[model samples]
Target: MAKDIPAVAAGNQVRSVAKALMILNLLAEHQREMSLGEIAKEMQLAKSTVYGLLATLRDFGYLEQSPEDGKYRLGTRLFVLGNVVADSWDVRKVAAPFIQSLVDELGETVHLVVLDKGEVLYIDKRECTKSLRIVSQVGTRLPAHCTGVGKVFLANLPAEEVKSIISTKGLSRYTKNTITEFHLLEEELKQVRQQGYAIDNEEIMESLRCVAVPLRDYTGNVCAAISVSGTLSRFEGDELESIVSLMVRIGREISLHLGYRA
Candidate 1:
């Protein structure tokens, strides 16, 4: 057998990758956003070289910039990739029983969706038996501005990024109830961020209403969202609040099961 490599020798084998990992570790330890200058100074690297690495990381969603200070912080994609790595524990499997219970309780369709390039991608659906139920298939992608689940994802993003996404995607009206104007959408999203949930309010489909709650990870970042969608008649007045409360509770419970401590 060949002689065992020394620990230092083994570690030095991939110096570039090791340095990249060191940068990530430094960012994580900082526990706050860092500017490009800050990161480069900490890494003792050339500005251009650090820029290339940061650009690559940002493009891959491993990092994101804060609009307030133009500094970089951990991105939502890291939480997403973490969930993927934790698939042995499996978010879908952990969430299924709760989702099934909710569908039974509410007698409405339930959806689990994740944010994708500022859009919402439906990954799973627990169908309702009602003949008039909303028909959404797994793997369907919808604009983030008008849907309940989509709003939950957007509300967690920084304000400038949110504005950029809307400006690029431009709120194509699906219904009169949709928040088409940037100012109106901005106000509602502020409310959404504060409330920890969002409402569709017949915005996507007339006479259809939805309430969505953020599904968080151990880092307390929203990796996905769960939503309940059904007819307006079922969501009128006090019933609407009731449904939202139930969904929020379910979301929290699911978050706890997904290794979120609080």
Candidate 2:
């Protein structure tokens, strides 16, 4: 009887499926790992029921439980699936040619990054052939406040949201040039917003400079950033300005390709 409609299911079956999906959604929404009790409380479900569902999910590789802390998180299976989905609509794919061009033109390392939970996640990198590049991996995550691309993405958000992110992530010092105070960072972000670009002046690594530009989507929201990094000696006064203009121009081109009109 239920064969005609593929979507049709018994009430109990549908309820079970919904509950399982809700657990997955919960894990996706939360930034940190959660305990079974916390998930049960958050979802208003009984501990026994939640534990059963979580155990089933964990056994199937959809979720993983930490042995040290007894916390649960989305497992590597989801990450594998996410990578598949990510590839289908990857901004890195659209920006690859342009990024390669920047490296070819500037002979410096180029990075494409996006903000993930108040941190910068590098999605793509074009290395300079001249052996003058920053030692950053494609999937490396760094504090958003300490990088030029991170600051570009950060400058696009609201003050309240920015404050919330800062509170959650905290301003941990990485170097002497890294901004550790909220007030000072705010002032720096204000300048970045006004200038339409951001610069990391030996902040992440001593004497390593980076200039970044924002990449906006079709809706004019900043979705990512592109940065060119090299040593300070090669990126001094006039050279720095030239590279900034070139990067910004190329960045706008990539944004347009990603469906942004302006």
Candidate 3:
């Protein structure tokens, strides 16, 4: 379902609340600092109106002003909100031990990720004992098209929403292997949905390989993904297939722990 932006107040209460939120949403989507004029242009609002709204949001700690560039971005309020949302998920707690176990058994990095808006948010991660490793920390957010967990999540989204996200997010190339074309990514997602798994073949980082499986909720809704990542040298053919199978089993186990029936 599409999220409803709050109704704009009419008549005397036309305080530009809707426009202010639109600006915030734009900034959030960009995931980068934006200047007041840039924000005004993007929002199609008067410079004065954008400035006033930004000032109000800054005063309330909902937006932060950078000292170096004087651009604004999401503030401490978002961090607080993110923490609240992260903590509310009982699945994170239930899956942490299993994630650790997977890391120990496979000797590779294991991660649990959930879709937040159009981005993939890493909720938990376990590091392997290998001397050399692929380092992905918890709380890291990445573009859905560039990572295994994100692709699996994207594979489960409605077609229109998938198009909407791709249109808005833009397929950024993180590495030479990254899928930067929308049509290619759509085809890849179709394969992922059909196979019930996704792979990141050095897309996000050079010489890294990862396999991911979706975690379904009680309603059979794809709610999260579990992945194992390591250097490319360690994953190939049977070894790669083994990790995929392991991830699928672990993912289903975690999903069942979260009350998933199937």
Candidate 4:
């Protein structure tokens, strides 16, 4: 017996497949188990049609129906797939092209760093063609209070965690511009969160300025930070605002590639 399924006319997209995906999206949006009738009503489809799609999805492990309530929710398969995606997001590999683009455009050194044990651990660095260079290397660790990248990470931490890091790291002063007091550092962090960026204003090395922004992961957590570094002359006057805007844009793009939504 031949089934009389209607052939979809628009670009070869199967109607059933599209409906099935829509059902999944609906469930995700609701973020709760849904009855067949509820799903059908929300999808504006017949109960029989929605039931068929739900049953197919349940059998395939993409959805689960409760024995008690008979309501459908997302299944462990999505979790497994999510893990696969997370595992593949090597931040260095994901951020490499964006960092290079920043370096090429701004003619400033760029760095990628993560917070490790309450300190900034530099994982990647791209240098510009300028003769005057910022002396930072991959695998170098610095106090989170003095560097732009470090403060960006710290700004996202809980107050207690920030205090704990301060207790351990001691806010060592590298230059006169370095924030050496707990109260002052707290104020600086508050400003970073407010402005969505941080600046190392000759704090770590005199005459070296850097602007940094946070990189987020799928769960909207700040997973790392990226920065553009140059001499105070390069970061001075009108060029400073342009560099800040470009760094923020690049940060968002790189974060998007890592599954961040906003």
Candidate 3, residues 134-251, lDDT tens digits: the string is: 6567878899998999999899999999999888898999899999988899899999999989999999999988899988888899888888888888889898888888888888
State the lDDT of candidate 1 residue by residue for 127-148, as single tens digits.
7687246758876889999999
lDDT comparing candidate 2 with the true structure: 0.87
Most lDDT-accurate candidate:
4
Q: Which residue pairs come into collision in candidate 4?
A: none
lDDT to native, each model? 0.85, 0.87, 0.86, 0.89
lDDT winner between candidates 1 and 4: 4
Please report the TM-score between candidate 2 and the true structure.
0.71
Error of 4 at 55 (Å): 60
Tell me the TM-score of model 1: 0.66
- Number of the candidate with higher TM-score, 1 or 3: 3
Candidate 2 structure quality by residue, lDDT tens digits, 80-198: 98788768755878998999989889888999999998899998888877947567897889988889998998899999989988999998887799999999999999999998899
- C-alpha RMSD for every candidate: 14.1, 7.9, 5.6, 16.6
lDDT score for residue 22 of model 3: 76
